[model samples]
Target: MRHLKYFCILFVITIVFISGCGNSAKTSKQHEGKIQITTTIGMIKDIVNEVGGEHVAVVGLMKSGVDPHLYKASQGDIQKLEKANIIFYNGLHLEGKMIDIFKKMAKKKTTIAVSKDISEDQLRGWDDGTEGHDPHIWFNVKHWITATKTVRDELIKYDPDHKEDYQTNADAYIKKLEELDQYAEDKIASIPEQTRVLVTAHDAFGYFGDRYGIEVMGLQGISTASEYGSKDVSELRDFLVANKIKAVFMESSVPKKAINAVVEGAKKKGHNVKIGGELFSDAMGEEGTPEGTYIGMVRHNVDTIVDALK
Candidate 1:
């Protein structure tokens, strides 16, 4: 169904491009006054908005609670991508299903993976794909600052007229991220060392855990596509029970069935566990809320975890 959806959308986009209805060059030329950017996820979009300010108009292809791992582009989304001046995405197969489309776009436009600038040593080990770095680089504020700098550079190249604006915005955003990084460190530090474990629906927070000094376990693997079988649930249940873990989290973009199953399995073993509040894993919150933004989302997750465990 996912493949079929994207295939149909691509076919429609191909017709639009052939018809010159939404040709990238023509649209870009028309919008020369403002750089039109298209991004895959909300986090990338938020960074673009901060850096680009009034100079760029960013259209995010993915919305709140949408799982990039399983997202398929729609006909409208393809049209938006077709008309974009530059496209930014969280590569490293984070958008696992959109690799071919991104490759196709790179031939004609400034299609970029913002996370590409970070060194491999800074990234956690990822077993899937040819790229070994974990794609959740945004979870680490420092890595995210590197990606934001890349975004600023791309914007400057495309629209040098607003170079100062982009630079100022990037610098300010990075400053805030630095503060956020420290806040996470201090908050996680305040939690008792034995209780600083985070168990979630998936391994999306490996980078988060590594950066903030928390131990993380996911019932599912790095990719949501990975299997979560009886053994996996049983082992996590045993670990949680033996250690008396206070909370297990569910991700906004992922179903809660697996986490619930873990809870059930723990119950069968005579231990009661409660669901920690939903964390914004693969996506942010809704558009209007504080949690919708990058900093707010991180703070919300950290506060929730700290309060629950402490």
Candidate 2:
């Protein structure tokens, strides 16, 4: 009876050990099959999802309307970076202070700088003579379409088994972008030539204005950390009064104080200029909205500019 009792105890222990081993194996397999990806901005996350479809799990580091230039990755973000199989960033110092961290990750992970693929000639520099390329390529639907293709190609290189699906999805998204580009052209054309001047708090709109032929002016330089001096406000007020500019624009990521300064300055000079509308400058709209996606964001920007300027 004692021997039989001892045998039963060993059998139960063996079963428990085997069960635990099985569960661990299952968890390991799940982790191995899962592909983790991180993108610098919400717009890039949208593009990656469009190409990756159901194959990838993506995380966007920057919140909507958060200035990428001033963004600092938290401890959670660092963990995400360590686990990510692939990473994507806008590059061109868009993530201003975060550039060094991204460069370090590029050495270890499959990091892709989406905007780096754009030609240098197409890029515009910040007003301070800093040649750091403008990182807002999504403003131009054609340029975004090209960047999406580059993203698709990079994703496929990492996950070749889903190449066909990625290519198909990217092609469809590109067609949608082309349609968006046409719509932008039509909408922007409705605005009178003189009203096409876009003045904002910072120099973020150079790419958009250059793409659509609107003249862009900003009270501050590209970096939001830079202070807007009285001279900057005075000069802008002069330009507004001289050109009879009807509207000045504010950015979602920037404080309204700078824009208010422009308005007050213009008012002091006897110019009646209205604040055009809130433009999605450095970042996009809230998640789950139409402006959340890259195409939707640009379309909203075009509509906002036309509605105000026209």
Candidate 3:
């Protein structure tokens, strides 16, 4: 009886080992033709799509209108992350909740923070009574140009077989970004300086404000995780009234309640402030739509701001 039990135990161990090796081989084969990449947000996914082109298969965890700051991973998301050959995120606590998971996965896979390439001095602080640098660096086209290079370098490092393709894609994208930068500058400059204030739900546009010389104000702080109190709304209403600003914008990912409060407050003071439009703040627009794309999203925001403020 003892001999039989030992034999069975050994057989089970052998079977388990063989199964593991088979799964490993199968995974390698599945990812042989193209790399499997997972990114935290649509912007990173879009960048990878532009740079990786046909050489990579990418998955984005956050969808349109999903706030990354408070997003927690589901079991399905974890599975995708585990299966990914590489993971990219706009770090600096942008995806504040997913940082731990990324750190844990870093031990086993290639995980990169794309925004880390930008220098600290170039980053702005969260004025909402929080510490650390703001993670919305993509708001500035110039900053995004640098971010594109980071993605390109990572793609080359892992998939040197597609070096030329990645480089070409990056160069093309950078040129488009340059054009976009010039366009934003011209449109924003056209808006009279007195009406250049950009007020939104949260302080997610520091880079945008700094880049284009708009005075940005948010009822809430940098992270949507923090609640915007009544006082914050009151203060923003006062700011809008004092500056004679015509509109306050809504973000796709953030709720419009805070902004509504500002509107109501301003209304009581006889200042009419309309919702400029829904701007793609933390997340992009729907997939397969122009607003769904990074460049399209930025253009949409710029156009909306210019139209409302002009």
Candidate 4:
């Protein structure tokens, strides 16, 4: 059934691509006016907006609080991708369901995975021996610096006329990311070392934990597509009680049910565990809020975790 759905989507994309050929002149004009970029997640959207600035117009397929693991492309999204001058995604199977769509679109357009350039040493593998590296690179500000550079170079490659602007914008953004990295280090250091364990909805913060020196655990696996049975929950509860963990976090993009169950189980076991706060994991906060941007989102998470754990 899933295979058939993907096939149907590809068929629609093929028909749209064939029909769109006649509008090449108009498409060229639009591309000439402003680079139309379609990104998969809010983090990439924010990076493009910061680096591309006024030279590019970006549309993110997934909105705030929308989990990319389960996100399916809509007809409107296909239109956006069809008309885009470039498409940027996290890659490493982050957008699990839309991988085929991205590959199909890449055949004709500039579809770049911003995470592609990160070296193997910098990436963390799944503890369960999952095939791919973790996709939550944005959690580590330094890795996001790499992604920003990738976005800058790609934008320059596609739109060389704005090369200087892209370079300048990227340099500035990278500097900010550097400062954000230091801030995270300092803030995370404030939490007592023994209580520095970060428990969340899923394993989206492995990079974050590695970068900031925190022990991270999640109720669900790396991908939300993977399920967590009662055994997983009970085990997590035991770990929390054993450590006297004060809080576990809920992700903005993930349901609270699993974390809630853990909390209830901990309570029944006579260990109180509060929901630390909602962290922006796969998705970010709303557009206008501070948590909406990549830097802001990281700062918010660091502050929330420090405040709760300290």
Candidate 5:
């Protein structure tokens, strides 16, 4: 019986070891001859897919409706980062929680920040005397164009053999981005200047407002991690009532309760404020949807804001 028990243990150990090896081999084969890219957000993932084209396999750690400000990397994410040939992220403390992990990965892998190329002159400062520029650079289509070029340059540097393909793809993508930028500018201009105020749950649209010629207000600060109280709500409520702001937008990644509170506060004060629509702030829409892609999301936001505000 003792011999039988020992034999059974050995058999199980052998089976487990063989299975583990097989899985590892399969994982390795999955990225064979392809640049395995792990990106922090869907925006960066879209840029990689556009620039890398058929040569790279890209995976995004944060999907649609994910708030990157508060996102923490999991053990699975760590493994994904480990397996990646290159990693792309939005720096400027956008992925605040994962900054340390990114530093560790930079020592071993090609970890690139797409926002690194954007100059400080183009970035917006916080209104609350806080340090750090706003990290939601994609809201401004022109700023996103800069990010696209950064991805293109990095991919070409890493995979020089595919430099021509990367450059061609980037040219096509930038053309589309330029068109999107024009569309946003035109649509925003149609709204009356006073009625062009964009109020949302958070201050994610400072860059958007600056680029598109609209005023922006938020109940919370730049990062959703910041807290807001009744005093903040009352102040915003008073402003909305005073300005007669027609709509307050909600972010897909942020909770609706805060905006709802603002809207309700306005109603109590005899100013009717509507929840304009949910905008893709920190994240994009679902995959395969029109808003899933970066250009699509921008168009959707422009149309939605125009329809509601104008």
Candidate 6:
């Protein structure tokens, strides 16, 4: 009887140990199945969600309205990148400061620069007179659709198990982006030709202006990190006065003081130029807001520009 009791106790112990081991194995498999994805900006994260569906856990390094040109990644961001199965970023120096770290990660992980597929000829002018593409390709809905496709293809390459789902989601998203492009074109057409001039704190909207036939003037160059000079202000003020432009715009990521200076200088020249609206240049709106999504961001900008310019 004593021996039987001792054997029963050992059997129970063995069963508990096996059960714990099984549970641990199950948890490990669950963690392994989870595909961790990291994106440079919130916009790319949004696209990744569209293609990845429920299969991925996605994180964005830069928050909404954060200037990518001057972004400094935190230690947590590096950890996220290291654990990520796949990483995506808007290339063409959009994340100018984060470029070095991203390049290093590319050596180990599946790092994809989505905007690398954009053609050189389609890009806008450079200070050096070369085809330096604007990194804000998200502004143009058509270009973004192309980017979405690129993202889908890359995601499919990494995760072939969900290729059909990725393709389906990408196609649906592209249709929505197409509708957004048409909406932008219609709204921008309502603005008179002369008033279509978009002057802002920086030249981030070069792609936007080119796409919609609007002329853009900026106090600073493509990079918001670059300092704005008095000469830039003087030249912009003269242009506003000479053109009789009624509105100048401010960017969400750029400091308002520079734009305010333009407004003040224009007023001194007897030109009544008002701030058109806060445009989403370098970044989109807050995460939960309507302007957070790429389509919503472009819509909000077009609506703002049309209301101010028309």
Which tens-of-lDDT digit does each residue in 216-246 have in candidate 6?
8888888777787898889889999999998
Clashes of each: 0, 0, 0, 0, 0, 0
Per-residue alpha-carbon lDDT of candidate 2 for residues 1-310, written as tens digits (9 for 90 to 100): 9999999999999999999999999866655665788998888899999988878878888888798878888999988888899999888788888777888998998988888678888777655676566677777777788789889999889988889999999999988888888898788888999788989999887777777788888888877877889888888889999999999888889989978988988898898999888888778889999888787788888888898899
Model 2, global lDDT: 0.85
Root mean square deviation (Cα) for candidate 4: 9.0
238-307 per-residue lDDT for model 4 (tens digits): 9999999999999999999999999999999999999889899999999999999998899899999998
**Which regions of candidate 1 deviate over 4 angstroms?**
1-32, 128-131
RMSD of each: 8.4, 7.7, 8.0, 9.0, 4.3, 8.4
Tens-digit lDDT track of model 1 for 1-310: 9999999999998998787855777866756778889999999999999999978888999899999989888889889899999999999888988899999999999999998889877878785555566778888888989999999999999888889999999999999999999999999999999999999999999988988999999988888988889999889999999999988998999998999999998889888888878899999999989999999999999998888888
Better of 1 and 2 by TM-score: 1
Steric clash pairs (candidate 3): none
Q: Provide TM-scores for the models.
A: 0.88, 0.88, 0.89, 0.89, 0.91, 0.88
Better of 1 and 6 by TM-score: 1
Poorly placed runs, candidate 5 (over 4 Å): 1-30
lDDT for 65 in candidate 5 is 93
* Clash count in backbone of candidate 6: 0
Judging by TM-score, tell me the better candidate of 2 and 5.
Answer: 5
lDDT of 1: 0.90
lDDT of 5 at 106: 97
Give lDDT: candidate 2, residue 70. 81
- Total residue pair clashes for candidate 5: 0
What 10-residue stretch in candidate 4 is worst by lDDT? 22-31
